[model samples]
Target: MPPAHPFDFGAIDDDEGDTLHEECGVFGVIGVTDAANFVALGLHALQHRGQEAGGIVTHAPDVGFQSVRRFGYVRDNFTDPETMAMLPGQLGIGHVRYSTAGSKGQTAIRDVQPFFGEFAMGGAAIAHNGNITNANALRRELIERGSIFQSSSDSECIIHLMARSLQKTIPDRMEDALRRVEGAFSIVAMTRTKLIGVRDPLGVRPLVLGRIGDGWALSSETCALDIIGAEFIREIEPGEMIVITDKGIESTYPFRPKRPRFCIFEHVYFSRPDSILGGRSVYETREAIGRELAKEAPVEADLVCPVPDSGTPAAIGFSLESGIPYAMGIIRNQYMGRTFIEPTEQIRNMGVRLKLNVNRALIRGKRVILVDDSVVRGTTSRKIKEMILDAGAREVHFRIASPPTAWPCFYGVDTPQREKLLAATMSEEEMRDHLQVDSLRFISLDGLYRAVGESRGRDASAPQYCDACFSGEYPVEPADMVEQGFRPKTAAE
Candidate 1:
């Protein structure tokens, strides 16, 4: 096999990365020899959550601190013995990132995390997994108050806030800093000997704990712990923080308690199928969504097919519930990662075909129902429909597992501008017309809730999960964007 090509992030523009991007993933471990190695494996497992860049920060009392921040995949960067050897320590934290509230594609090394800060007490490094909604305002305030920033990322503000805190302990200072901050966050941090984990008040993003024999570990998902042969513990409660050391772990709550509004999209598309979230299997939930979609939008089709990978479980559920045969109508080039080097305009125009191709023999002459998670800008959907038509499919019907994504996510996920969102601008019928499909139907919000085990469905007054992108019900206000003339949803709009 040829060596992996470097990620040429700048060439393609104009909704090339049309799908919704994940925020980031965080992991840390303590009481283990060469803890950074464990952190690297955990990060590699959670790499699906973020692939642009990765970083690890380790702490050894004698060696002080060792950090290695690099661009691209963890397997290519952190897995090398030489690089791992440089990160020797009993306590360490790591972050796998996608550009959200930071510089987009071609990420700077400074923007890569775990971001380290030298406090009066000792140095602390934080690996944050969510977006900060109020970052712009805080940055202006911090800058005015003599806080010089090194990176454009919103997460860097937490470090500045920590540096200004008067609290004696690093965790205490973190609490003080977090108290003033807002929006979704699940953070993993480390000092000299202690490893820390924290979730925002709403638990909008995921963070879990695990037991690593004589050590303890924290990760963005349980699947990561499984990669390192660690026994799963429990999810760190929303608004709670855990500080772990050689002896044991201590838990604390810094933010006030509220209804946990975990991101609902995690079950729909973001998380790995093997991961368990909210006491439910992510894979099972997706299957349920497909069942619900089939029940709600029963379509007559010769074959039920997934858009490959993310859409597979749902397609199986659709097939099971609808009595249609499930087939691999589309095949993904597994080696072609999310970030690939599109060197020429011809290859760039190939677009979705580079990553996906229709299983021509299977799709030809069939009324195919393509089950996909969601349609963002409809760029990929259009290309997919064209491919299916070119392959001689009699009809193409789209069944989305999640509700129409009409609003931009302010919590963590990187989303297109409101006007750029196909759902935001077009009704379901209009979207169908635009895609030139036989039919396009998305699962209802209530159906989505039920799929995720919310038997009662969504409560208009108080939703159980963060359906901000679907319902425009933001749990936390996006302050900075509002200041810049970005408006929240209104009843009339």
Candidate 2:
């Protein structure tokens, strides 16, 4: 049988011109009846991680394996009974995605994962989160060695590498494939009888294990587990791989040990507040960040206001710590998806107004402190400042939960290049002037570490988390990017 052509229904083009884009989310389950249904629910909870496309691959004893890939939101496609009916199995893996490594437009459907490969050992479907920085170099080598590529995704390189491995078992082959690869990866893969989960040596992305009845599941966040009524087991440790079968789960350490560099932004903006990460509630961590921000960057304001949803918890913490009353100054439109996930500037600008509006009554004659997750391009911040001032805010003070994002992220989060980042090119005063805020303050890097339970603060030599976006100290060397003349931006620059 010939391969199925990539599905390209109409494109869903919403724009997020100023915010950072999340990489992708992966989910897998084994030993369950109607496994695809649980995977759908898990994907729904992780929809915020990637809004562009979603795909699921499932294997059944009698029916073999099936896959369904689509462009647009998961709820739009995967929620339907008709779509779910096409995918039925005892073992399944799914992915919700935004392309950081592939082309855009209708053709991008080819890059939507969980990519399946029919290896000589049988069939394996892999769903990956986090970028493979050295993918191009590997791709060239693989192509030269007579490997035919299917998709433009960096992730496809893994499948090709696995095909050539001398290992007998699928798990061993996968481990062999990953050993040759570099950069951050948190992967969930499914074979006929087993579900496999692996996190990279530094664990730049998150992958967690869960239990549902007698079945086992792996997901990008604990929130996905909650949606499927799965009991949280524990996080998949860095450099670790787990293979789950009906018999039991087997663990393997495939990579040399290293200090884990979990992405700290997960607590700041990527994760849902309801999720737990690194053994702590993400909501509590953000709240602590807000309290720390208040201590480090105090300002006299009449009302402490969050930028809605993402900033609400931190704003509440700021209010408690600073003795300022909290109010709903900026009201988010619950009906709209995130503006940052949109693909164009024009649509993103329109989305900002459709997504958020100021509460005139709450802000009128008040010195409002706007607590936001982070400022990227300064476009959204500028627009919000204008909206607040127009609504009769006496003064608008900006407080950011995370430190200024000054560097691009290669390990998953889709940050702009250094030249495009507002912080990368401007000082705090310059950013304040550009955004036209009365004052702009970001939480210190030490404060962020403290909030995430690192009381002694970040060590310059060995940081606790992957803070490359703020500190420019990458845990993994970006070999491919460096070869292309990508240089890390210095603070002075």
Candidate 3:
């Protein structure tokens, strides 16, 4: 055979330096009729987790396995009759992605996942939801050994590792592959007759199991289970792997157990309000954050208003706790997606106007309190405050649901560099003046843990959740980034 061509990793633009981004979402189903349809619905519900592209891989008798990958929303691609017609099977897996580890232009479609590989044993399709910090280092080693690659995504590293494994069974090979990997991961994979799910030892990301009649489903959140009329069973524990076959589901612990470090930001912004995370309703958790903020930083304002959608739940809690009337002072455009994901600052600035508008009639001459999840660059918050003031508000006070984001997250979240973060360089008073509001306050770090059901507050020596962005204490060292001379901001800084 001729020499295999190497995959081009340099084509990817790794410098996404403006906003925080969730990695991706994965869903899988087995022992269900029309499994592709259910997987589509699950991916639809998870579209919030990732919006750039989506794909579904399915296995069936006689027809073998088929896939449909598209470069837009799930509803736009997977819901089409023509597209669904191409995918028919009883076992399926899917992914919705926002490209934390791949390029950002048209070539990005190559990275759209549910990545499939044909090994000597059979075919395995895998969809991953987190980042591998050592992917570049591993990719270099693989290429030096004459291993050609297909996609630019860090996820492809798993396939290459599995291919090189000497293990006989696919699950054995998978475990062997994961043992050599580092960083956060929640993976859903499928063989010819079985579906598999696994979470990293740290449990930095989320993956849950559900039951749909006689079938079993694995999803990134409980909301996906609700979308497909599935009963919530339980979360796939960290270091645990479940293989769902015709016989039943078999559980195995592949890695050594460690303390769980679930992402705290999930409750703040990533998860849907309707979802359940860490055995608590995400909506209730966010509301509790608002109430805690009210206790820590009370403001005597006439009206409380939210940035809309993500901030609505928290704002309601703030109003109830502070006895201020909640009003829809800012109306968001239902058609607009999130602005922070936009690649350029100019587009992000334009997106604010297209995405939200001020209710001039309600804000004129009234003291308004603006409730938002978190501020990164202070661009949107500053713009919103200006808009409120131009609408004749007597005073504009800003209340944030989470503590200041001073450090960059290297596990999976696409946070800007520490130097680019507004809080990394400015004092609280400086940030207040920078946004140009009457007053500005963020929830204290301990206040956030209290809202999340930690009554004793955050333990400095042993944190309950991954609050690295707020606290600057990373559970997992970003080895690859550290080698690249990327120094994280210390808490003392």
Of candidate 2, the 10-residue stretch with the lowest lDDT total is 1-10
Q: Model 1 compared with the native: what TM-score? A: 0.95
RMSD, each candidate, Å?
Answer: 4.2, 4.1, 4.1
Candidate 2 Cα misplacement greater than 4 A, ranges: 1-15, 338-351, 455-463, 489-493
Per-model C-alpha lDDT, please? 0.87, 0.87, 0.85
By TM-score, the best candidate is 1
User: Candidate order by TM-score, highest to lowest?
Assistant: 1, 2, 3
User: How does candidate 2 score on lDDT?
Assistant: 0.87
Task: Mark the regions of model 1 whose C-alpha exceeds 4 Å error after superposition.
Answer: 1-15, 338-342, 455-463
TM-scores across all candidates? Answer: 0.95, 0.94, 0.93
Residues 148-244, candidate 1, lDDT per residue (tens digit)?
A: 8888788899999999989999999999999989888899998997989999989999999999889999999999999999998899999999998
Error of 3 at 237 (Å): 0.6
lDDT (Cα, tens digit) per residue for candidate 3, span 178-245: 99898889999999999999999989899999999999999999999999999999999989999999
Q: Give the Å shift of residue 285 in candidate 2.
A: 0.3
Report lDDT (Cα) of residue 440, candidate 2. 98
